[model samples]
Target: MDIKRSYKGAVEISVILLFTVMIFSCGKDTPGTIEPEKKNEKWRTTAVKDSIGNQYYVVNTLDNKLEIRVDNKEGKTIFAEVCPTIDPAEIPSEAAMVITGVATPNKYISINDATLVLKIVMDDVKIQKKYIQLLANINLDTKKFYTKKYKIEKPEDWTIVDYNNVVHWYQNTLLVREGTDYDLNRGGGFMGLGQRGTQLVCYERDFTIRYTKDIDANLASYPSGSGGQYIPINNFEDMAFRSDGLISRVQIVTSVEDEWAGKKDIVWQNDLKKSSNIPADYSVRITDYNIQGDEVIASYTIFDEKGNVKYKRTGKWALSNGFPRGYTTE
Candidate 1:
């Protein structure tokens, strides 16, 4: 009897141990309740102001750091830097910084040198900052190269205007190509073509620069051609020249053998109107015209249809992408 009781107690103990082991094993094997390893969901991000503002889309990878910068009225870049992409909401309200920048969360970001108003969202919290950086670089003479973060939106004439009358077209603003007239003095016969933002390239040297609206930045550039954008060069006509040395109108005479369309295409003719030069403090000059890397300036005069002067603005001429070395006469 004693031996049987001992045997039964051992059996009961073994069963209890087995049942406990099974219960623990079942807890570990449950599928739905298993926890997954933590991962980062911050990838593939974008900054959308009201779903329609300038979107700073993150590019292919997120390993790159953010670049912030500030530029003057011209498209020249100023100071730039790399920073951690923190949630703007996490920044202290008393934090001192300037951060006017566009963000591409997947890739990087670039900003101008100015006191910016940034509303950053990180971890579902919005943080704001002021005095993010030094704002005096606008007048600085520095040529800084920044990683182009902003994917320039193609310019559409009809879709981008504000009640205050601000136009934000940023693509194909100017075209540049090899100049037909080669100068022995200048090594590269490179001439830039400024034109209406519609076409990608300028076929001929004669073209018109139409600012869709009043852009007071006194913008200028030695426009360059794109990698593959072709331009039509048919139908040439002689147009009148404005008071300035630029052509007021041009005549397009279609070549018998159209480079674009073989066989004498439709004989097309178009007329150009005179471009009213607004009073500006900068003069648009051909590339290499200014020899001094430190000394070049131009002026502009904005006038109304009646030829009445409306406004006069001034900008420093920069030969080497640095600060304006000089200015133009009024």
Candidate 2:
């Protein structure tokens, strides 16, 4: 009987030990626990090739750093750089960045056969409600890097509007839109009331990297004595971009008092003088415009208060010198 009890106790102990081992093994495989192999796994990886058969690999590590590798056509590792954290998914395949008020696409990272341009946004802890935008241009041929930094203010109430497809990279020039909000009050004393509206601003930055406010126009306006009503006619129209992504031309409606005052002179201005190097005397009221090769053809019209088209003429301007010499108006 002693031998039998001893054997049974040993068997029970063995079974308990086996069960405990199984429980511990299952616990290790539970949802919250990280497997040994996956502990060092990467968050994401992206691989792309440029036009000249240069291979590029972008890896997003678990700690939010980007590991970028470039290989030449001969499969030789030519360049490698570790950049700040930017989600691999945000980078677009195209060369242009489109900020449509809702989301800013990864076109911020543009890679071409000769150059790689990166637009990075960094927070500024030193300044309240401000941020820094860094533009890094890398020459793939020479492996040289150049950087431009822009300090931008962050407004609490303003928002980005896709705003006629604003923001583009025109060769060495950059065009971007900045939006602002304004409060307008109509009437006087106790009967006065206030309204809010957004102003869409178009800014141009040349190769010198200086920002110029090209157009400061509103999306809508609440005219005084109009009972806080909004009108959309006082906005930008016919924004056209060149083949190289430059805002070739834009038309601004200075006022829409014609809607209320019966007969108001509607002025249309061509705001591309500085960018295109056009002369200031060039007529701003261009009606129809087209860009063909290196020349720009535009039409102008003059109308009487009775809505009669009094005069119509067409002119051709050269983009090379911004002169109306090659072509004549009809």
Candidate 3:
């Protein structure tokens, strides 16, 4: 009977020890134990095509990172990049959330031939208080990626006026934002009469990104008591690009009035290797004579502010050499 009791007690103790071990295992108190957060590990992939039929595969790693891949016409991988992750806590959430006139939840907003614009938003319930809006511009050919953060309040008040490569030969994107000029001084010192204008934010590119506040203008003298007047002269006007993605010609309004303006048209020479300015008022029209073998023969006519013909010129430009021969001037 004693041996039987001892054996029974030993069996019970073993069972109890097993149950205790099971309880401890089920709990999260084990040494070096960690519970993985599966939500953060979730990710999604999206594919987009550009205007030129290039394929772009974007993978939102869901960890504040993006994996991008670009494929060319033959489905050959041309470029790939793994963008650096951003800290959600460091981003501000109070600003506006509208992009390109629409409130988007994380997605590609624009896809040019060689550029991609992505809008990344982190507004999950867990991170609603720490919401973040990031605009990323990725260049497939240059293998460059840049990001900018915006905090806007009103959606209807702001608009993206222009977003594209002003000069196709140059791999830079020009972004123009149209909104209310909040500076009371710009509105003739009034509240509701704020000036509505466009601001040149920056040139998105791999290198040499330029930031400008407003268009280049002149401050005209005003009466001693009043603020000076702002007169916008040198403004970006019409431009043309060659079939080979080179700058053909660009016209700039040098003066508000053509009476005093000179050299208002810039013609790209030598396949855009050099530039020549037309010594006259702004160009009224441009005509392409011929394009062959890295050479462009073009003609343009400039007119004065009074609609009178000021100058006319015809030139042949080549990529290998600047104006190979003398051009005709009228």
Which parts of model 2 have CA positions greater than 4 angstroms off?
A: 1-41, 45-57, 61-64, 69-78, 84-136, 146-171, 178-208, 218-330
With a 3 Å backbone cut-off (N, CA, C), the pairs that clash in candidate 3 are 96-152, 270-318, 271-318
lDDT by residue for model 3 (206-261), tens? 42455434433342111110111111112342224443224434443222352145
Give Cα distance to truth, residue 157, candidate 3, Å.
11
RMSD of each: 22.8, 18.0, 16.4
Cα lDDT for residue 271, model 2? 36
Question: Where does model 1 exceed 4 Å of error?
Answer: 41-330
Q: Candidate 3 lDDT (Cα, whole model)?
A: 0.41
- The whole-model lDDT of each prediction reads 0.27, 0.38, 0.41
TM-score to native of every candidate shown = 0.20, 0.31, 0.38
TM-score preference between candidates 1 and 2, better one: 2
| Number of backbone-clashing residue pairs for each candidate, in the order shown | 46, 1, 3
Give the per-residue lDDT of model 1 (tens digit) for 1-330: 999999999999999999999988898879866786442222323332311222322211233333334333343433344333333333333212222333111100112211112322222223211112111111122332222111111222112110111111122122211111211112322111232222222211112443222211223111121211112221221112222322212222222223334322122211111222433442332111112334332234555566665554343433323243444344
| Candidate 2 structure lDDT | 0.38
